[model samples]
Every structure is written in structure tokens, then in C-alpha cells.
Target: MPDDFAPTPTTLTTADGLSLEAQWAVPLKHRAKVVVAHPHPQHGGNMHSLVVSTLFAHLIGSDCAVLRFNFRGVGRSEGEHDFGEGEQLDVRAAVDSLAQSGDAQCPLVLAGWSFGADLALTCDAPELAGWFLVAPPLRVLGDERFKAAPDPRPKWLAIPERDQFNPPDQAQVAIADWTNAEIHPISGADHFLVGRTDKLNALIDSFLSAL
Candidate 1:
């Protein structure tokens, strides 16, 4: 990573008083601010997950401040995983961290992959301007826990055509009633999204550019 885009290690304190490990990169002139969440913790996901790290690098390169963090029990982050329940607070802490840093008026968006994507949908932070979800398994948490589906803010979903967890068609049906939500299917990509980071990054760039 270039010196200008190097991430600064930090810690985020969640509402439940747990300290989560995190890394934040701020560009010289940021166009927007973003908080990136990794996949499931039990599945070996953390701040350094491929998709999360790639998005962090791409966002900083595009002159956007970005933050990526490990969930409660993952990596060096404190506390145990409360399934998708306590994780919501972790996401909110990330959003709060970015909101308090600099340029409070800049667009703040949340981007997540797989398990993290499902978790993001459950967060209804007022500071979040929108969301960008990648292959979210809409069934991870029950529908009753989801709060973003009806939100009027713009939301973009990058669904994988062959996703083992949730294919494009299933994702479409899941979000059919969601307000201001748009889907962009990635051809031939699966749930893991191996070798598809570039496309995801491009989609994110376009999403931020339009904000």
C-alpha cells in the first residue's frame, strides 16, 4: 500500500463495552466515508478478509476514507460472538467511528460481504447514508431482525449468479419489497466470490461516485 493510503491501526468500543480491532485509512481528500464488515467470524473472517481488504484499498485509492474491523470475538477483538445479535453493535460502532473522525457531512456508507452483508441489513444507524451488500444470505438472521430493507436510503446489492448460499434469483425475491434497493448481478460468480474482487471494487466505486 502507498504511504498515503496506509491504514492506521485502531480500536473501536462497542455499545456493550467490548473493544474491537480495526484499521482505518484516510485519504488526503476524501469524497466519502465507508465502513467495511467482513464475513462470518466462525468461518475465519476478519478485517483482513480478501473482499474486505480489497474494498478498503480500493476506497482509499479512490480518495475515500475507509474503516474495516473484526467482529467481537474474531482476531484480537474482545468479547464472544453473540451470533448476529451483538454483531449489530459492532457495525454501529464502526459507523460511529467514521462519523466522528473528519468531514461529518461526507456520505457514510456500509459495505459487507456474505455473513457480514446479512449483518449490515440489520443495522439501522441514522448516520449511514446507504449500504452495499455482496452475496448476502438473507436467511442468516431472521426477517424480523432486518431493519434496512424498508429504509428509504439508497442500497446496492451485488448478487452472485451462482452463489451457493443465495443465488441472484433468490436475492431478487428477498429484496423485492425493499425500498430504494438496486441489484447488480455478477455473472459466473459464486458465494465465495473468488477472483471477483475487481468487479466488486468497480461496483463500489460507481456506487460512491453517485453518492
Candidate 2:
């Protein structure tokens, strides 16, 4: 991690009183805030997941306060797994926590990877200025919140070329009529974004910059 992006350890209490482990990275001056969610907790996803961590590193000096956390039942977070149900509250709680950080007036961006991406898409935080999704597995996510309406908020979807779950072709079909989502097909990237962290981070940075 870059010296400037070193995060401060923190704990967030969800609306249902679940304590979640998190890290907050804020530059000297910030113009916006981003709340990031990781992949499936049952699948070894956490705040430290490569994709999540890479995003944290990428936002180091971008004037954005970034918050990444482990969902319930993961890491030291309290409560059992609630599938994607209770996890929705977790995302909201994260947003609320960031809102209290004195940057509430700034644009708020939400981001996630795979399972986390599904949660971000289903999360109903109207305060969000944008949404960034990386390799979301449509088959596993049955939420209709995103598909039910046309959201005006900017949405960026990055589909890996060789994703294990959803590739660019499949992802395009799944989100064909999605609000204002702009899909980007990443070359040589997988669902885990292993060798494409740089590309993912760059795309995300570009998305945020345009906002």
C-alpha cells in the first residue's frame, strides 16, 4: 500500500447492531467519498481482497475518502451470514458511517466486486453519486431493484474478458437496459481481476474523475 493510502482501523455498527471491521483512507483534502464492499464472505472475501485493496491503493491521493469493510460473519465482524439480505443493511450502515465524517455534502460513490458488486447494485442508497461494479455474477444475484427502474445516477460496469462467472458478452446481455450503466470490457481479466488490478483501478479512477 502507498504510504499516503495507509488506512486507519475503524469499526462500524450496522443498523441492526452488528459490528463490522473496516478501514478508512482519507487524503488531506477530499472532494468525495466512496464506500466499497468485498466479494462473498463465505468465499474468502474481505476488506483485504485484492480487488478491494487495489481500489483502496488507487484512490490514495485522488481527493476521495474511501471506506472498505468486512461484512457480517467475516473477519472480526459480528453476526452470522444473512445471505445478501442483511448485508444490504451493512452497505447502508457503511454509507451512514461515511456520511458522519464531515464529507456528507460531497459526492458519494459506491463500489464492489462480484458478490460485493451485486450488493452494491441492490443497495438502495439514493445519496450515491455513482456506482462501480466489477464482474458481477448475474446468475447468483436475483435482485430486481436495479432492473425495475432506470436510475439516473451514473453506473460503470467492468466485465472481465475471461470471467469465470459472467463475461463481457453475458454481462452485456444482462444489463442491456440497465439505467445509465456504461459497460467496459477488460482484456485478459478474470472474475478475480488477478492480473488486471491496474486496469480495474484505472477504469474506476477514470469513472470517478468524470463524476
Clash count (model 2, backbone only): 0
Model 2 misplacement above 4 A: 1-5, 145-149
Q: Name the best candidate (by lDDT).
A: 1
Q: Write the per-residue lDDT of candidate 2 for residues 1-211, one digit (tens) a residue.
A: 4565568999999889899999998665677888889999888899999999988767766777899999999989899888888888898888778867845677888889888888888765777888888888865457464432267788888989899888888888877777787789899988887888889878987887889
Question: Which residue segments of model 1 deviate by more than 4 Å?
Answer: 1-4
Global lDDT of model 1: 0.90
Model 2: residue 89 alpha-carbon error in angstroms: 0.7
Give a tens-digit lDDT track for model 1, residues 11-55.
999999999999998766678999999999888888898889888
TM-score each candidate: 0.97, 0.92
lDDT score of residue 62 within candidate 2: 72
For model 1, where is the 10-residue window of minimal lDDT? 1-10
> For all the candidates, what are their Cα RMSDs to the real structure?
1.1, 2.0
Which residue pairs clash within candidate 1? none
